[model samples]
Target: MYRFLLTRQWLITLLIALLLIPTTIKLGFWQLHRHEARVARNELIAKALTATPEPFDSLSPAPGTAVPADLTWRAVTATGQYDPAHEFVVRKRTDANGTIGYFVVTPLKLSDGKGTLLVNRGWVASGDGAADYPPVPAAPAGEVTLTGRMRADETAKGSGGFIKDRAGLPDRQFNLINTEQQTKETGAPLLGGYLELTATTPAPADQPALIPEPNHSDIGPHMAYAIQWWLFTAMIPVGVWVLVRREAKDRAKQQAEPEVTPEAVPA
Candidate 1:
C-alpha cells in the first residue's frame, strides 16, 4: 500500500494532500491569532470607554503623536465655543433605539488659547423631507464646557468618493470625516482630531443627545472558523488511509479467488 501510494500518479495526490495539511493548519492558526487580536481590541475599547476622559492637552504637542493606549477612552473636559459655521454632517450613524441618523460634528474653539478641536456633538434624525434636517438646538456660545472622548482625525479621502459638497447648512448632505477640511474652510486653527461626546449628561431640550454604548465586533465566529479549518486538516489523512485500505481489500479478494479451466467449470 505504501509503495502504491509512492507510484507517480498516487504520489502526486499524496504530495498534494500532505502539502494541503500543513497549509490548512497554518490557515487555522492564522485565524486563531486574528481571533485573539479581536478579543484584545474589544477589551481595550471597553476599558477606555469606562475610564474617565483625560485632559486633551496631556496627549501631545503635535497631530500625529501617539497617545498612550490607556488614555484612549477616558472622559475629557474642554472649555470651548462651538463654531456652527464650520460644522459638517457625518453619514451612517444609528442610535441605541436603532434609528438611522447623521452625526453633527462642529468645531469647539478651546479656551486654553490652543487651537480648536472638532466635537462630535450628537446624532440627528433625517426629518420628514429629504431637504429637511431635524432641528438642531443652538450650541451654548462663549466659553461652554463640553465633555467627551478624544479620537484621531479622519484622513482625507481619495478621488471618486461618496462625499459631495452642498451650498447650505441643515439641508446639506455629505460624509464628513475629520474636521481638517471644515476648519480650513473656516480659517480656524483646529486641533488634529475630534472628540466623540458621550450622553452621560442631558443637553438643552432641543439639542440631539450623544449615544454612549460601547461598540463591539464579534470574535467568537472567527475561532469557530479556525476550528473548522483544523478539522479539515485532520480529516485528510484519515481519508487517505480509508482509500488505501479499500483498494488493498479489493486486491486481496481477487487473489484469493480460485481459477478453474472452462471444461471443469459448471454452468
Candidate 2:
C-alpha cells in the first residue's frame, strides 16, 4: 500500500505538500519577527518621550535617520518666527475620529540663527460648498518658543515625481516624502527636517489640538502567527495520511463485494 505512493502522481503530490509546509512556516516566522520589531520600536519611542528635552546640537541626522527603529521622539525646544507665507498644507490627514483634513506646516526661523525648521502646527478641516483655506493666524511677531519631537526629513519616492515643488503654497496635492523641491520653490532656507509640535498654548481656534499619548507596542501577536503557520505546516502530513487510508479502505471494500452474474436465458 505504501509502495503505491512512490508512483509519479503521488510523488508530485508529496513534493507539493513538502514545499508548502516550509513556506507556511517561513511566513509565520516572518510575522513573528515583525511583531518583535514593533515591540522594540514602541519601547524606544516611549523612552525618548519621557526623557528631558535635549539641545538640537546634541542630536545628529545621520543616514537612514527615518528608520523608526533609530528615531528618538523627545521633547525639544526652539525659538523661531513662523514664516506664514511659505506655509504648506499636508493634504489628507485624518484625525482620531476619522475626520479628514490637512496639516498646516510652515518654516520657523530659529532665533539662534542656526537655520529654519519646518513645524507641523496642526490640522484644519475642509468644509463643504467651497475649497477655502483656513485662516493661518499670523505666527506672533518677533520670536516665539515651540516644543515638539524632532522628526527626520522625508525622502523621495521611487521615480521621484510623487512629490513636486510648487511656485507657492500648494492647493491640492500629496507628498509621501519631504523633498527640497518645496523649499526651493518657496526660496526659503528651510531646515533639513521637520518638528511635530505637541503643545501650542492659546490654541488656534480653528485647528485641532495635538494629542500627546504615546503609541503602544505589542509583540505577542507575532508569536501567535508563527505558531499558526507551523501548525499549518504540521497538518499537511496528517492530511495526506488520512487521504491515503480512505482510498485504501474504499478499494478493499470494492474487492470484497460479490460480482453480479448474467441470468441464464432459454435459447
Candidate 3:
C-alpha cells in the first residue's frame, strides 16, 4: 500500500529534499557568521576610539610598509604641508544619514622631511558623480598640525591587493585608500596608515565634513534570519511524510467502499 514511495519520481523527490537540508543549514550559518563578524568589528572600533592621540612621528612607518594590526584606528597627529597635486578621493562613501559622497585624500608632506602621510580630509557630495569634481578647498600652506584616527592602507574592493590603474575612473578617484599605490605615483615616502582627519589646529572652512563613527547600536536581524532558514529546512521532511500519509488514506477509503453492481441490463 505504501510502495509508491519506492517509485523513481518519489525517490528522486526524497533525495532532493534530503539535499536541501544541508544546503539550507549552510545558508543559516552564513548569516550567523555575518552577525558575529559585525559584532567583533564594533568591539574593535570601541577600543580604538577610546585610546589617547599621539604624534605621527611616533606611529608612522617607513614607506611601503604594512601598518600593524594593533595600530589600526589609533589616534595620531601630524604637521605637514599638503601635496595638493597628488590629492585623490575614495568613491562610494555614505555619511551617517546614508547620504552618498566621496572622501578626499591629500598627501601631507611632513615638516621635518620625515615622509608624507595620506590624510582623508573628509566627504564631498557626488551628486553628478562625474569626473569634474568640485574644487576641494586647498589644505593650509606651510606647516599645519592635524589630529585624527590612523587607519591601515585599504585594499581594492573585493580584492586582497591593489591594482593600480586609472581606467574608467574619474581623474584622482581611487577604488581603494591604499598608500603604497600612492607611493608609486608620487615617489614620496608615505606612512603605512592614512589619517582620518578629525581636527586641525587652525581649521579651514568650506572643507568637506569629517565622517562620523559607524552605527553599532544593534546586532541586527541576522540571527532571526538564520533561525528562519533553519526552520524551513526542518519542515521539509515533515511535509513529505504528510503528503504520503494523505495519499494512503485516500486509497484506503476507496477500497472500503462496496463495489456497485450494475442493474441487470434490459434487452
Candidate 4:
C-alpha cells in the first residue's frame, strides 16, 4: 500500500515538501532577525533619548560626513541664526495626528561661523493649491540656541529608506532633508546631520509645532510572523503523512472487498 509513495505524483509531492521545509525555515529565521534588529533599535533609541544633551557639532565633526547610526536620536544643541531665505519644505510628511503635510527645513547659520546646520522645524498642512506654497510661520529672528534630537541626513541609503529623488518640484520644495543637497542649494558649508527642533531660546510668537520623539516602545509583528512561518514549516510533513495514510487506507479497502464468481453448474 505504501508503494504508492514511489509513484510519479507522490514523488513530486515529497520533493516539493522537502524543498519547502528548508525554505520556510529560512524565511522564519529572516523574520526572527528582523525582530531582533527592531528590539535593538528600540533599546538604542531609549538610551539615546535619556542621555544628556551634547553640542550638535560634537556629534559629527567633519562637514558632510554621515552621522553614526548609534548617535541617531541623540539629544544635541546648537546656536545659530535662521536663514529663512534658503528654507525649503519637504513634501509628503505627516504630523503626529497623521495629517498629511510638508516639513519645514530651514538652514541654521552657526553662530561660530563654522558651518550651517539644517533644522526640521515641523509640519504644516498643504495649501489650497499644490503649487501654492503653504504659509509656514517665520523662523525666529536673530541668533538663538536650540536643542533637538540628532538625525541622519535623508538620502536613499539613509534612515529615510530608498526614496526616489525627483526633479521639477514646486519652488522651495524638496524630497528629503539631505545635507549634501542643501549645501549646494544654500551655497554654504553644512554639518552632517540635521536637527528635529524641540526647543529654542526666545521662542517665536508664531512658530511651526515641534516634532515629538518617536515611539520606541513598539516592537511590531515580526516575532509573530516568524512563529507563523515556522508553524507552517512543521505542518508540511504532517500534511504529507496524512495524505499517505489516506491513500494507504483506500488501497487496503479495495483489496479486502470480496469478489463474486459466476455459478459454473447453472447450464
RMSD of each: 4.3, 4.2, 3.2, 2.2
Residue pairs clashing in model 1 are 52-74, 52-75, 53-74, 53-75, 53-76, 116-191
Error of 4 at 54 (Å): 0.4
Give candidate 2's error at residue 261 in angstroms: 3.8
lDDT of 2 at 162: 50
Candidate 3 TM-score, C-alpha based: 0.84
2 or 3: which has the higher TM-score?
A: 3
CA lDDT, every model vs. true structure? 0.70, 0.66, 0.81, 0.90
Candidate 4: residue 249 Cα off by (Å): 1.2
lDDT of 4 by residue, 1-267 (tens): 599999999999999999999999999999999999999999999999999999888886477788999999999999989999999998888899989789999988888877788999998999998787999999989999999999988886653575677889999998888988877876788889899999989777988878889989999999999999999999999999999999999999999997756874476
Per-residue CA lDDT of candidate 1, range 1-267, in tens? Answer: 345666788888788899999999999999999899889878888776777656666563354343455555556777767777767666656777878777888777777877777778888887676556555666666667777777665543432464454345444445565455665566665666667776423345556668665665666688998999999999999998898898788878877998878999887
lDDT for each residue of candidate 3 in 162-251, tens digit (9 for 90 to 100) = 434355876788777888888876777687889999998787766787878656567888889899989999898999889889988998
- For model 3 the local lDDT of residue 261 reads 65
- Candidate 2 per-residue lDDT, tens place, 151-225, comes to 766544432665453334446334432536555556655555567788654444544446445565554577788
Error of 2 at 172 (Å): 8.1
lDDT of 1: 0.70
User: How many residue pairs collide in each prediction?
Assistant: 6, 0, 0, 0
Top TM-score model: 4
30: Cα error in model 3, Å: 1.3
Task: Return the clash pairs for model 2, or none.
Answer: none
lDDT at position 112, candidate 3:
81
